[model samples]
Target: MPNPLDPSLATLIERHTGPVKQLRPTEHGRGSDLTALAETEAGAVFVKAMRDRGRAGGRRDSLLREIAVAPHLGGLAPALLWGEADSGWVVGGWEAAEGRPVDLRPGSTDLPAVVDVVRRVGELPLPEVAEDWPEQRWDRFVAPGEEDLFAGRALLYTDWHPHNFLLGPAGCWLVDWSWPTRGAAFISPALLVVELVAAGHQPAAAQGLLADCPAWSGAPAAAVDAFAAAHALMCRSAADRRPQQPWLAAVADAAECWAAHRAEG
Candidate 1:
C-alpha cells in the first residue's frame, strides 16, 4: 500500500528506520491520523502520526504528551525510539509490540496479567512532566464538592480499553499513552473495571478482577462510588453526542451498570 504519512514525515521516518519495506495500517482510531506497523531494514516498528491541522490540533498535543511520558514508562510500555515534527505532521516510532489485545470478559486467563500490569502502572513513579496533569476528565460530571475524590499523585493510564493492554510472549504491555494523567491510584483500575463491564462481565465480577490491585482493593467506598457515577455521566454524554458510534453507547451502558452496582452496595 501507499505510504499513509505526509511526504515530509515519510522522509523523516525513513531516515530513522531505513527504507520502509511495507506499511500495514493498524487501527488508527479516532485519536490518530496514521498508525502503521512498518517493516524496515532496522526491523519492525510501530508508527503513530497526526497532521497538525483542523481538529487534529488536539491530537498533536496528545502526540507530544506521549513522547514526553514514553521515556519514563520503564518497561510497562513500548520504548519510544524516535519522534519528530515536520511539514505539518507529528510522528512517533516505538519498539513494535508483538502481542494481542487482552480479553477482559469472564473466564479469560488474561485477567491475571491485566491485573498485574494495572498494579505496576499504579506503582510507576509520577513523571515530573505529568505533575500538573491532574485527572479531571470526570470533573464536569462529578457531583459538586466531590471532585477531590479523584485527586492524587499517581500516574494513570486513563484509557482502559482492552486493546490498550497487549499480551505477548514476554508479558503484558500497555500501549497508547496519549491521555496519561496524574490522579488517585484507584482511577486506573477503576477505569479498567468499566472496560471489564463492557466486555460482558457483571459489574461486581469486573470489580472483583482487580481485587489484587492495591489501588482498587484499598480505595474507599465513597471515592469509588463518586468516580463510578461521574464516569457514567461522562460515558452517557459521549454516547449521546456520538450517536453513530455504537461502542460508546455500549460503554455508557456498562458505566451506568457499574455505577448502579456501586450505589446498591
Candidate 2:
C-alpha cells in the first residue's frame, strides 16, 4: 500500500513558478524526504516536505516555525532563501560551515573545530523564533529530570551533527532547521559533550572550551544537562523512527549516553 504519510511533491511545485527539478536525495537520519534544487530560474532552494512523523501536527508546525525564524538565524547558520508553511519546503542556497561531522573516534581531526563551533554557536544571539520554548518548561523536554538544577535559555539547533553542516566558501553553514528550541539549562551543550565523549574522547578535553563558551558561558550545569538530554532524545527518537539510517546506531548510542550521564548526576 502507498504510504499515506508520504509528502506530496506536486503540492510544493504547485506553489512555485517554473518547472522544479527534483535533485538527488539528501541523506538524513529520518529517511530522505528533503528535496533540493532551484526553480527553472528562481535560485537554489531546499524543500523539506513533511513525511511520515514530520506530517504529525507538531512536527509540521515546527517546520513552519523554522521557516519564519530562518531569516534572523541565517548568518549564524545557513541562509534561508524562501519557504512556505503548508508545503514544508524551505529554500536555502548552501554556504560553508567549517569542519566535517563530529567524529568521536580517537584522534579525529574534526573534534577541536567542533568544540570551537559549539562555543561560538552558544554566543550568537537567539534567532528570531516566533515561539520560544519556555525556559522552565524546556527543562522537562531537554533535561533529565534532576533536582537542584537550573538552566538559562538560548536558541538551540537540536541537530548539530557534522553532516548537517558544511565547510563551504561562505564559512560554516548549518542547513537543517527542522528542529530548534529555546535554550534548556544544560541540554544543548551537555548533549554535545556527551556526543563527543561517546565518540571516544574524554569530556574533560572539551570541558575548558565548553566552560569558556561565550554563548552560554554562565549557564548553570543543570541547564547543560537538560540540553544534553534533549539532544540525546532527538538522536534516539530518530533512530527509532528510521532504523535503516546509517548514522542512527552511533548517533543514538551517543545520545543515549547523554541521557544516561544526566540521569546519574
Candidate 3:
C-alpha cells in the first residue's frame, strides 16, 4: 500500500528525525485516522495522524488533548516526542512503547500490574489544562439529581479496555490519552471493573481485583452505584448505535452486570 503519511507530513517528520528509514502503517485505533511506526535516525517513534476535514477532523481535538496531557502523565504513559499541525493534518510522534496488551481475565498474572498502573494514574495531580475538561461523557446517561456524584479533581484515564494497558519487561504503560478527563478518582477503577467483567470475570470478582486501590477503597458506595448505572446506559446506547459490533454489546452486558451488582450491595 502507498504510505499513508502525506508527502509533506513525511518531509516535516524527516526534518525532526532525519529520513524515515521505514514506515509501517498500523491498524486504526479508536481515535486516529492514520497510525504507524516509523524507523528514523532518532529511532522508532509511534506516529498518529488525523485529517482536519470531515468526520476525521473532530479527532484533531483529541490529538491536541493528548499532546497537552502527555508531559503531565509522568512515566505512566508513553512520552510524546514531538507533535505538530501542518497542511490540514494533526500529527504526533511518541516514544514507541514495547509491550503486549494486558489480560483482564480472572487469575491472569497481569492483573496486579494493571491495578498498580491504575493506582498510580489516580494519584497524579490534576493537570491545569484539564481543569475545564470535566468528565462529562456520561452526563446524559447519569441519573437525574445525581450528576454531582461524578465530580472530583483527579485526572482520569477514562478508557479502560485491556488494550489500553500494555505490560512488558519495562513495566506497564497506559497508552492512549485521547479522552483523558478530570473526574472522581474512583472512576478509573470502576471502569476497569467493567472491562474485567467483559473479559469473563464475574462482576463481584472484577471489583475484588482492584479492592486495594486507594481510589476504589475510598469510593462512596452511592457514587460508585450511580456511575455503574450511568456507564451501563452509555454502553447500551453505543451498542445500539453499532449493532454489528459484538464487543460493544458485550461491554453493555458487562456494565449492566456491574450496575446490578452495585444495586444489590
**Top candidate when judged by lDDT against the true structure:** 1
Model 1 TM = 0.94
- For all candidates in order, the CA lDDT equals 0.88, 0.55, 0.86
- What's the best-to-worst order under lDDT? 1, 3, 2
Q: For model 1, how many clashes?
A: 0
Please, what are the lDDT tens digits per residue for candidate 2 over residues 218-263?
Answer: 6665656655666566667778899888678777786666556656
Q: Which stretches of candidate 3 lie over 4 Å from their true place?
A: 1-4, 28-30, 54-57
CA displacement after TM-score superposition, residue 149 of candidate 3 (Å): 0.6
Report the Cα RMSD per candidate. Answer: 1.9, 5.7, 1.9
Model 3 scores worst on lDDT over the 10 consecutive residues at 50-59
Off by over 4 Å in 1: 1-5, 28-30, 54-57
Among these predictions, the greatest TM-score belongs to 3
lDDT by residue (tens digit), candidate 3, 128-209:
9999888888878876768889999999988887787778889999988897888899998899899889999998898888
Between prediction 1 and prediction 3, the one with superior TM-score is 3
lDDT of 3: 0.86
